[model samples]
Target: MTFKPLLQHFKEMKHYFIVVVLVFGVSFYLGWANSEQFSHFLKDQLEGLKSLSQSLSNKDNPQMWFFFIIFLNNAVKSVAIIFLGLPLGILPLFMLVANGMILGYVLSLQTHESTLSIVLKGILPHGIIEIPVILLACAYGLKLGMLVWKSAAQIFVPVANRTASAELKKVLTLTKPLIVIIVVLLLLAAIIESTLTYWLVHL
Candidate 1:
């Protein structure tokens, strides 16, 4: 299969990448500002998850529901802009950064030496596909936001009115497939991560 679309997908996601980084920068600042509080929060969450996972090991447990919830929560945070319309850019970016930081901090809390192993084993399978898929979905939102901003600008500039129709059509066409493709890829990635990757890691 061609990696070109995947590469182009990354290229298109570049804008969101910058936005995500900036959001993380802000999170890092917050983290830096209140290190103790943040640290405590991370520790508590980690311990809570571990306990929850352990409890769910039994056949009768309902904690398995958490897996789906967590999965959807992760997916929604990345694609939240879709429903929010043009206003999604800032919030999605913020969510992305906060997610990365939270992930980084959580891994750190788990084990320093095994950090790399844990991340690779736990995240790589689904993350490789899922993260990009999420980014692409958000890109569609960004494209919409750009269109709206451009449309609003047309009120002041005659040139803005010149090609709005054509440009808007192109944007809509480009983004529609992006939403579908991303969702498909994400599901495939999640499957690989949950099954094959899980087995390999244990091996």
Candidate 2:
């Protein structure tokens, strides 16, 4: 799409972006503070994925599988946030909190220096793009939830029906571009994560 529309989209979604960031920050801090607890929680959750993770990790040329897995995971999450926002936006917020807490809990296990090094060498390469895409998806998801609320609240008012219809149309129009951007960024992130991130951490 054109730069103007993209820029406009960013401006419109700025507030939601900030909200997502704040939510993430608070959850991250909580996770860090209760690292031991979250650690146990995460471990239990991860237990089911251990075999899958191990299998992926053992590949001699894991990049293909890594990219496929990461891309699929991100795509599913983005779709969930966007579509599931109709349920009062709770799903999108849950995603932000869950990811933030896991990230914080995992980081807390590392030494300060190691954490810094990891952030710089491992996360930054792909995270720069991936994080924003995630936040944008969440912001749009929250926006969708707001739209649903607005439509529901004005359901009884005849005049409000037209307004609600317009709003729904607007949301649908905006979501198309958002989904496209998210897909592109996630693809890039998958590539970098499979290559640059892998090499950096292994080094």
lDDT of each candidate versus the true structure: 0.59, 0.81
Give one digit per residue, the lDDT tens place, for model 2 in 133-168. 887788878888887887877776656245765766
What lDDT score goes with residue 32 in model 1? Answer: 45
Model 2 Cα displacement at 56 (Å)? 0.9
Among all candidates shown, the one with the greatest TM-score: 2
- lDDT score at residue 71, model 1, on the 0-100 scale: 55
Itemize residue pairs with steric clashes in candidate 1: none
**lDDT per residue, candidate 1, 1-203, as tens digits?**
44455456667557766665565556655654555667876567568767855665553533334445445555555455654446524555545555555666756555668768877888787777776565555555665666666776776777824465566565555555555565567657756765666566667
Models 1 onward score TM values of: 0.65, 0.89
lDDT top scorer: 2
